[model samples]
Target: MQSKTSSYLANLLQFCIDNKIHKARKILHAYLLRTNQFSNTFLVNRLIELYSKCGHPTSAHLLFDQLSARNIYTYHAVLDAYCKSNDIDNAYEVFAQMPERNSVTWNLIITALSHNGFEKKALENFYLMMMGGFVPTRFTLASVLSACGGVSDVGCGKECHGVAIKLGLEGNFFVGNALLGMYAKCGFVWEAIEIFKGLPEHNEVTFTAMMKGLMETDRIHEAFDMFKLMHRVGISIDSVSLSSVLGVCAKSSFEDFVVVNDNDRNWYNVHGKQIHGLVIKLGFERDLQLNNSLLDMYAKHGDMECAEMLFDNMSEVSVVSWNVMIGGFGQKYSKERALEYMEKMKNHGFEPNEVTYVNLLAACVKSEDVETGRQMFDDMSCPSLSSWNALLSGYSQNEHHKEAVMLFREMQFRNVQPDRTTFAIVLSSCAQMGLLDGGKQVHAALLKDVAYTDLYVASGLIGLYSKCSKIEMAKHVFDELPQYDVACWNSMIAGLSLNSLEAEAFIYFKQMLGKGMLPTEFSFATNAGTTNVSLGCQDQHCEYVKILFYNRYLAK
Candidate 1:
C-alpha cells in the first residue's frame, strides 16, 4: 500500500513540475507533511525541483535548508533553483558546501556562471574540474566553449576544441553547434564554415549562427545566401533567422554594388520586400521583433513610404518601431518630420530613449541647428557615448570647430571617456582650425586607449598632421595602420599631394592600383586638383599627373 501511494505521489509531483502548478504543488507539500511522508529524501528532492521549476526560488531554498537527509540530487535540485533565478552567488555557496559532486554538479555551476556573465570564472572552474580528475561530459565542454566565445578567448576555445576531438565527442550535435558558434563569434568565419559543413545535419540554430557570423564580418551577400540556402534546404526558418536576413539586406543596400536590371532598380530593396512577403506567408507577421526588423530594413534603405505603411500595419508596435521611424526620417534629413514623429510618439505614450535622442541630434546636424541640438542634449539625464558623439559630430560638421574643441575639453573634465568616433571628430576639428598641439594631445589620449590603429581615427590623425604641414608625421600614422582600406590610401595620397609631393602621390596611386584597390572619383580629383594648382609650372611631374588623371577617367 505504501509503495502504491508513493508511486501515485511521484506521478502527481511530475505533473506539477511539467505544468508548473505552483498552487497545487504547495498543497502536495502540505499533504506530505500531514501524512508524515515529508522525510522521504526522493520525494523532498522532487518537491524542491517543482518549486524551482515554478520560479519559487525562496521556497525551494527554504525546503532545501530544512532537509537533513540531503543527497547529491537534492543539492543539484536546489542549485538549479538558484541558477534559474539568476542567484549565482547562492548557487556557488551550495556548490562549495557539497560533500561530493558529480559531473552534473560541475556542469550546473559552470553553465550557471557562464550564462550569468561570469565567463572567466566559468573557465577557471572547468580547469578545476579537470584537475579534480573528472572527465568532462559533452555538456561540460559546450558550457566552457560558450564561455570562451563570451570572453573572445579563442586560444582557450581552440584548446577546448582539441579536448572535444580527443574525447571523440566533437561530432555530438550539441558540441558541434557550440563549436560552430564559438568559432563564428571569435571572427573566424572560415573556421565556422568548416565546422558547419562537417555537421551531418543542419538546423535553424546552426544556420543562424553562420549567417550572423557572416554579417558581423561584413559578408552581407554571403549572409543572405546562407538564409536562402536555409529556406531551400527545407529547414524551418524561425523569426530570429528571418530578422538576421533582414539586417543583412539593410546593410547590403548600402554596398556599392549596382543591384539593378536594365531599368536600374535596386535589387537589394526588392529582396528586402520579398523577405517581408515571406514573413507574412509563413504566418510570422504577428511576431513583433520580426516586424521591427522589417521596418528597420525599409527605413535604412530610405523608403519612408514602405516603412510608414508597415508601421501602421503592425498590430503591436514597440518603442523600437518608433525609434526606427525617427531614425529613418533623420537619415533623409527631414528634421521637421522627425520632430513631428517625436510628438506623435509622446502622444502614443512612448518616451524618447538614448537612440532616439542621437537620431534627433543627427537631424539637427543636417540643418546646422546647433542651438536646438544643444538644448535637446542638455535635457538628457545621462547621455551615452553615442549621444556625445552625435552632438560633437554636429559641431564639427557645422564648422563650429572652436566650440567643438571646448566640448571635448568639457567631456574630458567630466572624465567621460571618448571612443573612436569622438577622437575622430575632435581631430577633424583640430585639423580644420590648425590646432596642431590639440591634435597631438588627442593623439596621445588615443594611444593610451590603444585605438591608434583604428582606420577612422588614423585617417583623422593623417589629415591633422598633413594640414599642419607635418608630412612625416602623417606618413608615420599611415604606416602604423595594421591594414589599409581604400579610404586610408586615399587620405595618404591626398596628404602627399597637399604637401606638393606629386611624384610620391603618383607612386602611391600606382601601388593602390597594383593592389587591386579601385580609386574613387575623390581620389582622382584630390591628386589632380592639388597637382593642377601647380599646372602653370609645366613641370614633367605636372604633365605626368594630368595625363594620368585623364587616362584613368577616359579608361573608365
Candidate 2:
C-alpha cells in the first residue's frame, strides 16, 4: 500500500509538471504533508521546479524552505527559482551556503548572471567555479564567452578560447559559435574568421556570426561573398542569416546601379531578392524582424514598390515597419503618400514615434512645405534633438533662412541645447538670410562650446562669412582651424570662388592638389563658376586652370 501511494503521488506530480497546474501541484503537496511523506527530498525538488516553471517562484521558495530533507537538488531548485524571480541577491546567498555544487550548479549561476546583465559578475563566478574544481560544460563556456564579448574583454575572450582549445571542445558547434560571436562582436575579425573556418560544419548561426563580424569590420564585399557561398552551398537559411544579408544589401545601395521599378537594383539587390524568395520558400514570411529588414533594405535601395507590398502584407507591423515605409515615401519625395501613410498608421491604432515625425519633417522639407513642417514640429510631445534638427534642416532646405534663425532662438529659449547639427544649419541660415549679427552670435556660441569644432562646423563658418561678404573674416576662420579636413578645404575653395576671389581660389585649388586632396563635384562646380572671374585674368593662369581640370578629371 505504501509503495502504491508513492507511485500515485509520483504520477500526480508528473501530471502537474506536464500540464503546469500550480494549484493541482499545491494540493498534491498538501496531500504529501498529510500522509507524512513530506520528507521526500526528490519529490519536493520536482515540485519546486514545476512551480518555478509555472511562474510561481514564491510558492517554489516556500516549498523549498519546508523541505525537511534538503539535498543539492533541492538547493538548485530554489536557486533557479530565486534567479528566475530576478532576486539575484537571495540566489547568491543560497549559492554561498551550498555545501556541494555540480557542473549544472556553476553553469546555472553563470547563465543567470549573464542573463541579468551582470556579465562582469558572471566572469568572476566562472573563475570561482574553475577554482572549485568543477569542469565547465558547453553551456558554461558559451555563457562565459558571451560575457567576455559583452564587455569587449578580448583578453578574457582569448583565455577562454585557449581553454576551449585545450579541452578539445573548440570544435563543438555551440562553443565554436560562441567563440565566433565573441570575436566578431569584440572587433577581432581575423580570430573570428579563423574560428569560422575551423568549424567542421556550418549552421545558420555560424554564418550569421561570421557575416556580422565581417560587416562590423567594414569588409562589406567579402561579407556578401560569404553570404552568396552560404546560399549556393544549400545550407539552411533562417531569419537571422536573412536579416544579415539584408543589412549588407542596405549598405550597398550606391547610385550607379540599374533601377528595377521604383527600387534601384544594385548588385546586392539580386542577392537580396534571392534571399527573399528563400525566406518565402522556407515559410518564414511571418517573421517580423526579417520582413522589417527587407522593407528597410528595399526602401534604402530606392525600391519602395517592394517595401509597400511587404508592409501591407506583414501580419505583424511594428512602429519600425511604419517608420521605414514612411521614410521610403519621403526619400522619393512623395509627401502626400507619406502623410497618407501617417494617417493610416494612426487609424491602425499606432501612434507616431519620433522617427515617424522625423521622416515626415524630412518629406515636408523636400516638398518645400515649411508651414507643414513647423506644424508637425510643434505637435511633437517630446522634441528630441533630432526633431529640432529636422525642422532646422527643413528651414534651411526651403530657403526659409529667417525662420530657421527664429526657430534656433526658440530652441535656445526652450533650453533644447543645440548640438553640432544645430549650429551648422542655423549658421548657414544666418549666412543665407544675410544676417551678419546673427552669424556672429552663432560663431560665438561655437566658440563657447568646443563640441561644435568638427569639420562641418568649420565649413559652415567659412560659408557664413563668404556669403556675408566678409572675405577677410572667412580667411581668419579658415586660418584658425587646427585641422584641414576635405570639407574644410572644399568650403574654403567654394567660399573664395563664390565671393569673386578667383586668384585666391585658384591658389587654394593648386595647394589642395599639392596636398593630394582630390576635389569633389562641389569643388569643381564652384571653381567652374569662378571661371567667369578667371576670364579677365592672364592667359597663363587660364591655361593652367584648364590643365588642372583636364589632369584631375574632377567630374562630368
Question: What TM-score against the true fold does each predicted structure earn?
Answer: 0.85, 0.67
- Across residues 31-65, which tens digit of lDDT does each residue of candidate 1 receive? 89998887888998999999999898889989998
Residue 10 alpha-carbon offset, candidate 2, angstroms: 7.5
Where is the poorest 10-residue window by lDDT in model 1? 253-262
> What are the RMSD figures for all models against the true structure?
4.0, 6.8
How high is the CA lDDT of each candidate model? Answer: 0.88, 0.85
Kindly list the per-residue Cα lDDT of model 2 for residues 1-556, writing each as its tens digit: 9888887777778788888776787677678789888777777788788887777778887887788788999889888888887777878888888889999889888988887889999999999988889889888999999999899998999988989988999999999999999999899999998999899999888898888888888788888888888888888877888899888878764632223554743334676677788789889899999999999888888778888888889999989999999998998889999999999999999998889999999888888887998898888888889989989998888888898999999987888888889999998899888899999988987888884567789889998998988988988998887778878888888888878788789789778878888877677666666665675564666667666677768454
Please name the candidate that would achieve the greatest TM-score relative to the true structure.
Answer: 1
Candidate 2 matches the true fold with a TM-score of 0.67
Steric clash pairs (candidate 2): 263-302, 263-303
